[model samples]
Target: MALLIEWKSGGNRFMERCNGALEAEILACVEGIALALHWTMLPFEVETDWLTLTQMLQSREKDLSASAHLVREIRRLIDGDREISARKIHHAQNQYY
Candidate 1:
């Protein structure tokens, strides 16, 4: 479902596992950030292997995809709250992290 790992010096960190829609995982990230990173507005960077989700988030478009609703939820959480960004990277790049 969802998991969170925090480092003494890193503030709050998390890793989530999802076997269903990829958008759910993205939603988890949004929720996690909102709850854990609660404070003055700050920029948060998220890396993902799902290029489609990333594109949707970056473009602020919600349509066609099953995860579109979740994407919209993420956008809502990010709206006027935090600068949350999603970047696409190869799966291999995140394998060891």
Candidate 2:
């Protein structure tokens, strides 16, 4: 599943069932980011709930974990431009009943 939310404009949402582990689904979501946003929309920042992703993106050394390729791809996109930035932010807690 992929989600895109713009401040002023409306957002887009997508859902796709994947036959793999959670890591694989995470990779799918990360990969979809590039396609979700436009190239000309550089100098933009993405606030994420996942602190690990934020750390991975900001890290200089490549992450060689199971999601290495996924992280590497995201790093490539971040490196492709100069003004792009990503940071970890607290997300609202969800209650699972």
Worst lDDT 10-window in candidate 2 = 1-10
In order, candidate lDDTs are 0.62, 0.59
Off by over 4 Å in 1: 1-21
lDDT of 2 by residue, 1-97 (tens): 2233433223344646443554553564465466545544535666566777778778898587777777777777666544666776666631122
Counted clashes in each candidate structure: 0, 0
Per-residue lDDT tens digits of candidate 1, residues 1-97?
Answer: 2232331122333446444757555765666657646753456666677887678888944466766666777777777744556789797865532
Question: What is the Cα-based TM-score of model 2?
Answer: 0.60
Task: Tell me the TM-score of each prediction against the true structure.
Answer: 0.60, 0.60
Which candidate tops TM-score? Answer: 1
Clash-forming residue pairs, model 1: none
Error of 1 at 89 (Å): 1.6
Give the CA lDDT, 0 to 100, for residue 19 in model 1. Answer: 45
